[model samples]
Target: SQQGEEDPQALSIQEGENATMNCSYKTSINNLQWYRQNSGRGLVHLILIRSNEREKHSGRLRVTLDTSKKSSSLLITASRAADTASYFCATSGPGYSTLTFGKGTMLLVSP
Candidate 1:
């Protein structure tokens, strides 16, 4: 099973600041996605970038994928205390429906 690794295991920022996290994977994939999880809850899909796509955006979130480097990055602009959560990147391999998730980056936003 292929898995992704997220950098800066933890992050802390003030409200209205921006938060960025990176994910690196080992295998070829069809699509890569980012998800956010609040404490003690399930994950909510944030955005997805295909192997052929270099960048994508959703609301205040920005996602970039570099298939050549087998890596992706997620950015959240104007972060809020409500945005404090763990962010994870998941990748689905070719012909595989299962997605393997990264360790996750915990973001803390101060009010």
Candidate 2:
């Protein structure tokens, strides 16, 4: 499968805590992106890191990529109850316009 694989399939945390998710891919990719979906609905783009980038951050989210290991990680700081959602990592490989997404990591944040 072209899809990536995410670790720690599910997580539960209290509000204001940090949550981390990891993903690993089998093949080379041009870029890696993280997304969040609420209630099994559409996904919302969170951040994108290029193959050449080691780390990228936006708001309370931080992402790291290690091409040598074909792995990536997403971290959310000071998570809130609203942060409860499923996160996914997706990658676009060479010569492929569509992105293959990982299964997902379900996060539950309690207030």
C-alpha RMSD by candidate, in order: 1.0, 1.0
Estimate, for each residue in 21-111, the C-alpha lDDT of model 1 and write its tens digit: 9999998999999999999999999898989899999999999999889899999999999999999999998985799988899999999
Q: After superposing candidate 2, which stretches have Cα over 4 Å from the reference?
A: none
Model number with the top lDDT: 2
lDDT, model 1, position 108: 98
Off by over 4 Å in 1: none
lDDT value for candidate 2?
0.94
Error of 2 at 72 (Å): 0.4
Q: Which ten residues in a row have the lowest lDDT in candidate 1?
A: 1-10
Model 1 TM-score (2 dp): 0.96
Q: Candidate 2 lDDT, tens digit per residue, 1-111? A: 647899899999999999999999988999999999999599999999999999999999999999999999999999999999999999998875789999999999999
